[model samples]
Target: MTKEENLEKMRHSTSHVMAEAVQSLFTGVRFGIGPAIEDGFYYDFELARPLTPEDLPAIENKIREIVDADYPFIREEVDKEEARQLFADQPYKLELIDEFPDNRVTIYKQGSFADLCRGPHVASTSEIKAFKLTHIAGAYWRGDERSPMLQRIYGVAFDSEAELEGYLARQAEAMKRDHRKLGKELDIFSIHEEIGPGLVCWHPRGALIRQIIEDFWKAEHIKRGYDIVYTPHIAKLALWKTSGHWDFYRDYLYSPIEVEGQEYILRPMNCLGHILIYNSQLRSYRDLPLRYAELGTVYRYERTGVLHGMARVRGFTQDDAHIFCRPDQIEAEVAGVLKLAQLMMSTFGFNDYELLLSTRPERYVGSIQMWDEATDSLATVLEKLELPYDLDPGEGVFYGPKIDIKLRDALGHAWQGPTIQVDFNLPERFDVCYIGDDGAEHPVVMIHRTVLGSMERFVACLTEHYGGVFPVWLSPLQVVIIPIADRHVDYAQQIKNELEEEAIRSRVDERAERMSWKIREAQLQKIPYMLIVGDKEVESSNVSLRLRSGEDVGMRSLLQVKSLIKAVIEARAQTALEGESI
Candidate 1:
């Protein structure tokens, strides 16, 4: 078997052993589904009482004992009636069985525990060589809020000890770089119970960073021949129905509102609005490929359990754009979007990423000929660009085929970055057309794309990627001036004024705190530069500079420092000084 398949088998079998150990310790505990996740596995249990951290070691010890026994995993195929009798006490299992339409069922048994599962586990418990129980959390059965909450025990298994150790080390680093923890410490953003879950309130610092990102996005789009536009956050519900979103995407949409006896909905996507703008006037073939861009805010209903800090939220602004082009212009427009996406990602220090081509799905719209043509166009772009991509068959959106870009961060973790899709369904449904050379009206092809995905999630990814030590170009507070004593406060203000005149985001720390304390605070805030003003520096008309890395650069003239910062900002450098000493 392949290495990945083997690892999955080992992890799944370890979870079975873990369940056996739990049943041995806690009698009469009902089981829930346990499946292998990205790097680990988790099993849910309905125990009589809540499990604590103290209980983990005992469970781990029991699991080790079971592993030592070298129990073989036996699989059996039974009829529905037999399976029902075997798991009569497990209401969850019975519910799962009832949902299946077939009479045949599969079960896996190891030691004294058995579960109704369709699994390809390892041959025996001894194959689970390296394993560790990580932590516990409360998960609702079947992920539904109305169901009973269960205790989830998470664990990871690997083929070798070294691999497990490396994974553990990365996990430790990830904890330190957790965006939620850093967000609170840096006072960037917050979510309160009163304000509702999945809704973020950006503090001053976070808002400033967002503004900078938005400004950069708009400027780049304008430079690339895109017309920036604004659209309302709500529109008539009939619009969604005509666009087919109400039929396919209604689950994520909020409840409708009655305005003047007509139903309106909070916008869940910006594509429909862009299409409406294209349909506002008749167009000729010369006016084809009109690119419309918007940093539009959208709302979607997400379950509370799945809501994360800013990575997953109910409301967010999408760096969205759509192009309405003729059939012959489809390939060029898609290639142009690919280039723009690459530029944006590389600017953010993401040099390594993966691209995927998703083909037509089972429930796709438009004719077979149209779907084939659109899919061929997307594939041709990837081929012509010589970009390597994976083919995900039957995974495209209902309306079109798409190219998905995933960016890898410093920790070797991947996150969704950009998406480019060629759509024929929307134009057909909305009756968007342009006059062809033959003096006949033909349907316009729509291409929807986004470079940053969403503002909130992108910022969250950036926070963890850089560990909150943003480069000078993107740092909300680029520089902080620290005064040695009350006597030097005037000099520090003068330095701040000079930096501000150059359009640098600088701050003067005029607090009644010691110079060392102020410097430490600035360092903790992860500012790019700290300018120290003292009696000696003021006498010489210079300021001592210290980088966030604690590298001390000797005193330099005020203009020299300003010149250094401006150069970095103008170049949009991704690092503070590029390891240069002033």
Candidate 2:
């Protein structure tokens, strides 16, 4: 067996042991599905009371006992009726058993515990070498909102203690770098329960950072010949039906609202609007490759259980664009998007990333020939650029095939960043066309893309990637002036004003706090620069410059400091914060 298969089997076996432990601990615990995930394993159970962190230790102890016993895992295949009899007391199991179409069913047993599962477990309970019960979460029985909610215990298992410890260390770092924690600490963004979950409210600092990013994004798109456009949030439901979204993507869409007898719903994507704009007028071949871009907000019905901080939200603004071009322009357009995605990633300090070429799904709308051509175009571009990518078969959007850019952050966690898709179906559905050289209207090839994916998620990524210490250009508050005493407050304010004039963001901390305390607070906020003004510096007409990285550049003239900061911001340099660089 391959190493991956062995690891999966071991983890699966560890989950079974955990289930056995839970069964022993609780009076009557009814289990839902338990499966091995990418990094670990999780088991869902319906218990009398919710499980807590304090209960994990007891469960772990029970698991240790089972492991020490070294009971062999025995596999049993029996008729459906026999399986029902075996798990008559477990309602969830009975429900699953009823769903099985065949009479033969697989069950595994170790010692006194048994579960309805297919075999592939370790030889014995003792094979689980290293494991840890990480945390607990609430999960629906089958991800249905109206279904019964169950408690899910998550854990990680490895072949060695060293591997387990390494994973735990990374988990700890991930907790520290979690965007939710850092966002709150840095006063950037927050989601309030009163405002409803998954909706972000950006504070001044966060809004400023978004403004900077959007400004930079607009400039880049203009340079690449993309026309910025705006579209409404809600559109007539029939429009989506025409675009094939209502039928294929209904699960993610919200129900339509009647406005004066007309049904309208929140737009789940920005592509259809762009397509409509393309069909708005007759176009010649000279206007081929018309790229329309929008930082448009769309709403989707993401289940509450899957709602995460910025990562999976109900509403987000996609840095979305659509290109209408002739068939021959597909390669060049795809290549341009790749280049833009690469530039965006590199500018944000993402040096490691993977590409994925996704093909058509079974329920896709386009013809087979069109699907193959679209998939081939994306593959050809990746190969022409000599870019390595994995094939994600049947993972493409219903409209077309795509190339996905998954960027790796500082902790080597991959985040979805960019996507370039070739679409031939949407233009057909909307009858988007341009006049050809033969003086006949022909179907236009459509390309959909996003360089940064979404502003909310990208900012979340930026916060975690930088550990909240954003580079000079991206930092919302580029500098803070800390006055030593009341006498120096005026000098600090003057410095802030001067920096602001240079288009550098700065604030004067005139609060009634000690200078050292203020500096520490500024450092905590991750401001790029902290300028200290004191009686000595008031005499000398200069200030002490300190970087958020904890490096101190000795007293320097305000002119010198402003010049360095302006130059850094102008160039959008990522590594100038460590005093030595200056």
Write model 2 residue lDDT over 325-438, tens digit each, in one string.
999999999999998998999988877778999998887777899889878888999999998999999999887899999865545567788999888778888889999999
Per-residue error (Å), model 1, residue 154: 1.9
TM-scores for all candidates: the values are 0.86, 0.86
Q: Which whole-number lDDT from 0 to 100 does residue 444 have in model 1? A: 90
- Candidate 1 residue lDDT tens string, 269-317: 9988888888899999999789999999999988777787888899988
The root-mean-square deviation over C-alpha atoms between each candidate and the true structure, in angstroms, is: 4.1, 4.0
Candidate 2 contains a number of clashing pairs equal to 0
Which pairs in model 1 have colliding backbones? none
Candidates in order have lDDT scores of 0.89, 0.88
- The regions of model 2 sitting more than 4 angstroms off are 1-10, 26-39, 44-54, 70-130, 137-151, 158-166, 193-195, 254-261, 407-415, 578-582
